[model samples]
Target: MITLWLFILIGAVIAFFWFGRQIAEAAQQHAVGQAEKLNVQLLSVACVKRRLAVLSNGRLGIKSQFAFEFSSDQQSAYTGTMHLENLRLKKMDIPPHRMG
Candidate 1:
């Protein structure tokens, strides 16, 4: 019984990491798409923060927040944020960038 419990605990740890990785990938993809749509260059998208919270619809979910850096001319840098609810893009906040 002890060994069985240990195995279960190990499995849970692995699954948690796997899920986190998947969420990060999804956030990156969403960030890239947004940058393209806005005609800005995506410098980097990294999962800098995450939290569990009740969404607007009162549904409990993992809110994966990513901080992204972008540039319009590769000389100036700007910051942006992307929020995901269980791997689905819930919202994005990007400041105005200079146009080429």
Candidate 2:
């Protein structure tokens, strides 16, 4: 009886490890699929922004302000100010930036 109990204990440990590995692999595959979809959608959007900066509002997980320069044609320049809602961008202000 003691030997049988020992064998069952070892089996339980092996099963736990196998189940954990399978769950982690499934989560990683889901993340990869979502990233691929985002890449395709971003390619369709023609706007390009650069020289970005993020400002925090002194609260946890809250971005108070953001500033960047973007040009749709990649030739002209403009500065943008974005407002955040629930950690996502809600509004954007992009006026023309004077070039030298």
Candidate 3:
């Protein structure tokens, strides 16, 4: 029925946003952890880029990148980035900064 298809379409839209939110949350957590591991204080985290791509294992998944700000001495802020394939961390690029 048309009503059934309409419901399905709405459900798919909701699911897509929900999935994106899940990935963003995972990226934030991972970014925070990485900053802590480097002994820096995480100031902010935000999702910067996202797209569907084939991962290293050839599995199609959402590729996400998060940009974050951190401070080594709470005085100077530095920028960093984290990349994820779905929920798996692919790479992290941290700018050189003095270690506190």
Q: Which candidate gets the maximum TM-score versus the true structure?
A: 3
Candidate ranking under TM-score, highest first, comes to 3, 1, 2
RMSD (CA, Å), each prediction: 1.8, 14.5, 1.5
Error of 3 at 84 (Å): 0.5
Model 3 C-alpha lDDT per residue in residues 30-99, reported as the tens digit of each score: 9878887998999998988988889999988889888999999989999999999988898999999998
Give the C-alpha miss distance for residue 36 in model 2, angstroms.
1.0
Over the full model, what C-alpha lDDT does candidate 2 score relative to the true structure?
0.43
Better of 2 and 3 by lDDT: 3
Q: Give the TM-score of each candidate.
A: 0.86, 0.38, 0.88
lDDT of 2 at 94: 47
Tens digits of lDDT, candidate 2, 1-100 = 9999999999977965665444344433433343353332111112232222343544433223344444444465455455543234546554644433
Model 1, span 1-99: residue lDDT tens: 999999999997797788889999898889888888988889998887777789777898678889999999889999999888879998899988898
Q: What lDDT score is found at residue 91 in candidate 2?
A: 61
Say which candidate scores most in lDDT: 3
Clashing pairs in 2: none
